[model samples]
Every structure is written in C-alpha cells, then in structure tokens.
Target chain A: TQLLEQSPQFLSIQEGENLTVYCNSSSVFSSLQWYRQEPGEGPVLLVTVVTGGEVKKLKRLTFQFGDARKDSSLHITAAQTGDTGLYLCAGAKNTDKLIFGTGTRLQVFP
Target chain B: DAGITQSPRHKVTETGTPVTLRCHQTENHRYMYWYRQDPGHGLRLIHYSYGVKDTDKGEVSDGYSVSRSKTEDFLLTLESATSSQTSVYFCAISDMGQGKAYGYTFGSGTRLTVV
Candidate 1:
C-alpha cells in the first residue's frame, strides 16, 4: 500500500502570515493534486502537478512537485482568514486510484 | 460538489446493525469512489467502481461492501456497524481515468456514527 505523509499536521498563524505545507512519500507518483477543504464541506481541487520539479500558482497559493515525484509542497502567501482550512495532497500512480495524504489543518486568525 | 450527492448527511446507529450509504451522480462520470475521513488519517479510499456492476476494493475495504448496479448510483454497506467505523464518508466522481491532472469532485459527505 502507498502512503503519503504530511508535515505540520496543525498550523495556527495570524493573517498575512506565510505558511508552507509538505507532503512526502517513499513511493513515486505519476501525478499529484492539491485540495483545500473548509468546515462542513468536501475538499475542493486546488491544483494538479504532473511533472517533476513543476510549480503552479493559483492566486495566493503555490504548489510544487518534487524532482523525484515522491514529494510535493503547498505554499500560501499572505494567508487570510478565508484561506484557513484543511489542505490535502493526493497522489496517483499509473492506475485510477488516488492515495490521499494525512492532511494539514491551517487556521488563520485576525 | 455540484453533480455528486451523498445521502443521509448524518446518521447514528447501534453497533452490529447494518448501515448503508448512497451516492448519486448526474455527471455521467465513469468513475466513482467512496472514502472515509478521520482526524490524522485524511481521506482513505473504501471502494471504487469503474462502471455499472463493476467494482473493486480499496485500501480500507475490510468490513465494508460496495455495489454499483446502475450508472448513477453507488452503494456502500457496512456488514455490521462497529464503533471504529464512525467517520465522515465522502463520495467522489471523476470523468478521467488514472485521475491524470484533473482531480475528483467530491460530495458534501455523509457523517456516520456507530454507538
């Protein structure tokens, strides 16, 4: 079985602070996707990185896939209250199945 | 998400009782998956179906069964509810295979509790 391990399981920061969440695994993946989920709702797709060492930016969020395709990271710039949520990283191999990371719970306070 | 829906937003039942959860989709996506989310465990895939009457177990398929008799509905049943089974269940739909670059659209989720 493949497993994705995420770091800093819980994060609490003030508004305007920058934070980085990391997702690591010993197994390599063909593609990796990032998602952010608010309370009482399912996670929403943020971005998908298919290439090693590739970086994609979406507004204030930036996602990067490691050179080995075995890790990924999500960086938030000037996080706001609305950016507070559970961030999840999902990796897929050659099949249709997706293995999701443990998750990073972020909280931004005023 | 928009096209996917999960039934019984919240349910609480006694242990050893059978419990079933439903997932309905209108997008006509060929792939459907069931997952359970728990603190420190993120979302764990329970089962998935590639097409009607076709299904496969996921990483945490033990003690759970799934059936996909129709194109639009997928059902997950717990043979006998156990306290450890209490968790938020999510259903997701995707039109692409290998999940590729496009991620899945997930339902609000079904909160199940076993006492």
Candidate 2:
C-alpha cells in the first residue's frame, strides 16, 4: 500500500503567525487532495491539485503539489484560532482508493 | 454539504455485538466510501461501492463489511465489535468519475465506541 507521511505531527503557533505543513510519499499519484477536519466532524476538502506543480489558493491558505506528484504542501498565513484543526493530505493513484497521510494537528492560539 | 447524513452520530456498544452504520445521500452519486478515523492513523478506507450491489474492499477491510442495495444508501456492518473498532467513521459520496474533479462530499461522521 502507498503511504503518505506528514511532517510535524503536531504544531502549536500563536495567532497571526505563518505555518507550513508538508506531505510526502514515495509513490507517484494521479492527484492529491488536502482536507481540514475539526473535532467531531469529517474532513472537508480544501483543495484538489490534479496536475504536477499545481498551485491553488483559498483566502489565507495556499496549496502546492510537487513536480513529481509525490508531495504536497499547505501554507497558512496570518493564522487565527479558527485554523486549529487536523489537516490531512491524501494521494490518489490510478485506482479508486486514496492513501491518506498521517495528518498534522495545528493549534493556533489567540 | 451534499445532503449526506449518517445515522446514529454516536454509539456505544458492548463487545461481541453487531453494529451497523448507515449512510444516506440525496445527491444520487454513484460512488460511496466508508472510512475510519483515528489519531496517528488519519483516515483509512474500509470499503467503497461504485454502484448498487457493487462493492470493493479497501486497505483496512479485514473485519468490516459493506452493502449497497440502493443508489443512495450504503451500510457498514461489524459482525463482532472489538475495542480496536472504536473510532469515528465517515461516509463520503462522489459522482461517477475518477473522483479528482468533482471531489467527494463527506458526512458529519459517526463516533463508535466498543467497550
């Protein structure tokens, strides 16, 4: 099975700070997706990058996929308390299954 | 936000008992997935169905079984609950495609605890 590893299993930062989370895998993927999950809720899709070297932005959040399609990164600028949650990255191969990363727990204090 | 709803948002059951989680979608999507979420492990797919009565196993499908008798409903059943099965279960639905473009919609999730 393809495994995706996320860096900094847990992160704690003060408000108005900037943080970046990384997801890496040895296997090439057809696509990659980033999700943010809050407590007692399922993950919500943040962005989906299909092409290699693709970049997408949502408000203060930015996402980028590696040129090799095996890695991705999420950067949050001017973080706030609302940004605290578990962030996950999932890699999709040619098959229907999606291999999810270990996840990064972000805690932004006010 | 795709009209996905999971029944029994929270459940606590004894060991060696049967438990079933229901996922209902009003979008009539052709693909449905069941996943378990735990700390450190993230979310692991248990089963998925591409169409009615068509199912496939995922990476962690050993003790989990799924059934899809209709286009809008999927069920995940545990024959005998175990402590290890205690986790939050999520249901996701996507349109008939490669699941890259349309993106999947997830339910609120059901938290199951086996003691």
Candidate 3:
C-alpha cells in the first residue's frame, strides 16, 4: 500500500503570515492533487500537479510536485482567516484511486 | 461544486444493524467513488464504480459492499455496523477516467455513527 505523510499536522498562524505544508512519500505517483476542506463539508480540489518539479498557483495558494513525484508541497501567501481549513494531499499511481496523506490543519487568526 | 449528493447527511445506528448510504450525481460522470475520512486519516477509498453495474473494491473495502445499478447512483452498504466503522463518508465523481489529468469533485459528505 502507498502512503503519504504530511508534516506539521497542526498549524496556527496570524493573518498575513506565510506557511508551507509538505507531503512526502516513499512511493512515486503519476499525479498529485491538493484539496482544502472546510468544516462540515467535503474536500474541494485546490490544484493538480502531474509533472515533476511542476508548480501551479491558485490565487493565494501555490502547489508544487517534487522532482521525483514522491513528494509535494502547498504554500499559502498572506494567509487569511478564510484559509483556515484542513489541507490534504493525494497521490495517484496509474489507477483512479487516490492515496491520501494524513492532512494538515491550518488556522489563520486575525 | 459537482452535482454530487449524499443522502442521510447524518445517521446513527447500533451494532449488528445494516446501513446503506446513497450517492447520487447529476453530471452523468462515468466514475463514482466512496471514501471515509477520520481525524488523522485524510480520506480512504472504500469502493468505486466505473459504469452502471460495474464496481470494484478499494483500499478499505472490508465489511463494505457497493452496488451501482444506474449511472447516477452508487450505494454503499455496511452489513453490520461496528463502532470502528463510524466516520464521515464522502462521494466523489470524475468525468475523466481514473488516473486521468483531471481531479475529482466531492459531495458534501455523510456522517455515520455506530454505537
């Protein structure tokens, strides 16, 4: 079984601060996806990175896939209160099923 | 937001009882998936359906069975509820086939508790 581990499982920061969460794994993946889930709702896709060393930006969020496809990272610029949520990283091999990382819970306070 | 919907937003059942969770989609996507989320565990796939009447087990398929009778509906059944099975369930749909370049759109999710 493939597994993805996320660092700094819990993060608390003030608004305007910058934070980065890392997702690492020993197994390589064909594609990786980042999702942010708010309380009482399912996860929403933030971005998908397919190429090694590829980076994609979504507004204030930036996602990068590692050069080996075995890791990924999500960086938030000028974090806001609204950015408080659970961030998940999922990696997929050659199949449709995704293996998800434990998760990172971020809280941006005013 | 994907047009995916999960019925019984919350449910509570006793041990040894059978329970079924339903996932309905309006986008007519060819793929549907069932996953469970826990505090430390992000989301674990339980089962998925590729097409009508076609389904397969996922990483955490034990004690869970899925049936896809129609393209829009996927049913997950727990033969006997166990306390360990309590978790938040989510339904997702993807138009692109599995491992495609696209991501999945998830439903609001259903919270199930077994006592």
Candidate 4:
C-alpha cells in the first residue's frame, strides 16, 4: 500500500502569514489531489494534479506536484481565518480508491 | 456539491444495534464509495462499488458491508454497531473511468456515534 505522509500535523499562524504544507510518499501515483475539510463537513477538493511537476493555483493557494509523482506541497499566501481547517492530500494509482495522508490541521487567527 | 446526499446526518445508537447509512447520487455516476474519518486516522475507505451488484472491500472494511442495487444509490450497513465505528462518514461518487482517475466529489458527511 502507498502511504502518504504529511508534515506539521498542526500549524497555528497569524493572519497575513505564509505557510506551506508537505505531502510525501515513496510510491509513485497516477494522480494527486488536495482537499480541505471543515468542522461538521466532508472534505472539499481544492485541486487535482495529474502530471508530474504540475502546479496549480486557486486564489491564495498554490499546489505543486513533485516531478517524481511521489510528493506534493500546498502553499498558502497571506492566510486568513477562512483558511483554518484540516488539509489532506490523497494519491491515486491505477485504482479508484485514494490513499490519504495523515492530515494537517491549520489554525489561522486574526 | 457533488449531487450526492447522505441520509441521517447525525445518528446515535447503542452497541449491538443495526445501523444503515444511505448515499444517493443524482448525477448517475457509476462509482460510489464509503469512507470514515477519525481524529488521527484521517479518511479511510470502508467499501466501494463499481456498478450495481458489484462491490469490493477497502482498507478498513471489517464489520461493514455495502450494496449498490441501482446506478444512483448505495447503502452501507453495520451488523452490530461498535464504539470504534463512531466517526464521521462520507459518501463520494465518480464518473466511471474519467472521474475515478481525475477526482471525486464528496457529500456533506454523516456523523455516527455508538455508545
């Protein structure tokens, strides 16, 4: 089984600060996805990077997939209170099932 | 936002009781999945269905069973509810080959607690 490990299990930052979360794995994946989950709600997909060395941006969020397809990173610029939530990264091989990483909980305060 | 709905957003039951969770999709996607989210374990797949009457186990399928009788509905059942099964459950749907390989849309999620 492919295991995805996320760094900084918890992060607390003040508003306007920049932070980066990392997701690493030894096994290669066909696709990689990032999601944000809030309290009492299921995770919402932020982006899906299919190719190696791919980069996608959504507003203040930037996602980058490693060239090896074995790692990914999420960078949030000027994080606000709205960015506080649990961030998760999932890797998919040939199968439909996603191998989820140990999530990173972010707390952004004003 | 994935045309998916999970019934009984929150439920509390006693041990050894039977419980069923329903996931309905309006998009008529061919792939459905059930997953549980815990504090430390993140999200773990319990079961998934590729088509009607076709189901398969996931990483944590023990004590849980799933059924898909039609293209739009999937059911998950727990024969005997256990405290360990208490967690937030999520339902997701994908569009066969394209959706599965690209990404998945998740439901609002259901919170279950077994005492």
Best by DockQ: 1
Better of 1 and 2 by TM-score: 1
Pull out the clashing pairs in model 3: none
Residue-level lDDT of model 2, residues A1-110, one tens digit each, is 43899998999999999999999999888999998998888888899998999999999999999999999999999999999999999887867767789999999999
The lDDT for every candidate, in the order shown, is 0.94, 0.91, 0.92, 0.91
Candidate 1 residues lying further than 4 Å off, grouped into runs, are none
lDDT of 1 by residue, A1-110 (tens): 43899988999999999999999999999999999998889999999999999999999999999999999999999999999899999999979889899899999999
Error of 4 at A47 (Å): 0.5
lDDT of 4 at A89: 96
Write candidate 1's Cα lDDT for B5-110 as tens digits.
Answer: 9999999999999999999999999999999999867899999999999999998999999999998999999999999999999999989879887799999999
Docking class of 2: medium
* Runs in model 2 lying further than 4 Å from the true structure: none
TM-score of chain A of each: 0.97, 0.97, 0.97, 0.98
The digit string of per-residue lDDT tens for model 2 on B1-115 reads 6589998899999999999999999998999999998877788899999999999998899888999999999999999999999999999988755665556789999999999
Which 10 consecutive residues of model 1 chain A have the lowest summed lDDT? A1-10
Clashes of each: 0, 0, 0, 0
Consecutive 10-residue window with the lowest summed lDDT within model 3 chain B: B95-104
Error of 4 at A13 (Å): 0.2
Rank by lDDT, highest first.
1, 3, 4, 2
Please give each candidate's TM-score. Answer: 0.97, 0.96, 0.96, 0.96
TM-score of only chain B in every candidate structure: 0.97, 0.97, 0.96, 0.95
Q: Per-residue lDDT for A45 in model 1?
A: 93
Weakest ten-residue segment in model 2 chain B by summed lDDT: B95-104
